[model samples]
Target: MSDAGKLRIDKWLWFARVVKTRSAAAALCEDGSVRLNGSRVDQAHKAVRIGDVVTVALTGRIKVLKVVSLAERRGPFSEAQHLYEDLSPEPPRFEPPSPVAEREAGSGRPTKSERRDLDRLRRPDD
Candidate 1:
């Protein structure tokens, strides 16, 4: 790529395979979930440079990554992984799974009429 050709932040994130799609990256940018140099960036068109720190807030967790290289196009996993380095010192700890609700005993699968009744309950009066 030429010196003038630089990867956009959102495009880089997508090319890096950080998020599933380009739209997701744009959404993250619009939502202020993605930041550059400790400040939120509004436009996804911003150019990304090597060594720039990127913070991504995703699904109730935050991930920090450092841009290591620029990619103009989406590539294979090996190539994508080289684009950035995860700098989070620690992994997000797992929370214990919630307890399942106890079901009443002898509550066997409903019959055809019972199924209809359940479906009726789901519908609003009209």
Candidate 2:
């Protein structure tokens, strides 16, 4: 933690375990995938302070996190979780519709005799 109560966004992200590596965090920032208080951030050196909202766009989801504190080093998962407050919305849930074709229980496949009986029913004695 800096005496000024500010840390570089990339370092903070890495310290908080937001990304696998610091370089990845810096690249994310440089790619404009990070937003500080709703403003786009394209630099990794940008300063981040407590109580600031940081929005990040990942591969398939967006994360909104509020900085709670600054970290001095990359720490354990439990410790890293305290560095920020997650504000991301819940992901949508999809429920598949029931199948249209329903089969009777214990009915495997029709026997050869069953097929002949069905065919005779359809021929109408002709």
Which candidate leads the pack in TM-score? 2
Predict model 1's lDDT versus the native: 0.82
Off by over 4 Å in 1: 1-5, 95-126
After superposing all C-alphas onto the true structure, candidate 1 shows an RMSD in angstroms of: 6.4
lDDT of 1 by residue, 1-126 (tens): 222446789998898888999999998898888999788988888878887899998886688999888876789998888888998668667988664433358998887987777667667473
lDDT of 1 at 108: 83
lDDT of 1 at 95: 86
Each model's C-alpha lDDT? 0.82, 0.90
| lDDT measured at residue 103 in model 1 versus the true structure, 0 to 100 | 34
| Candidate 1 pairs with clashing backbones | none
Instruction: Supply the TM-score for candidate 2.
Output: 0.73
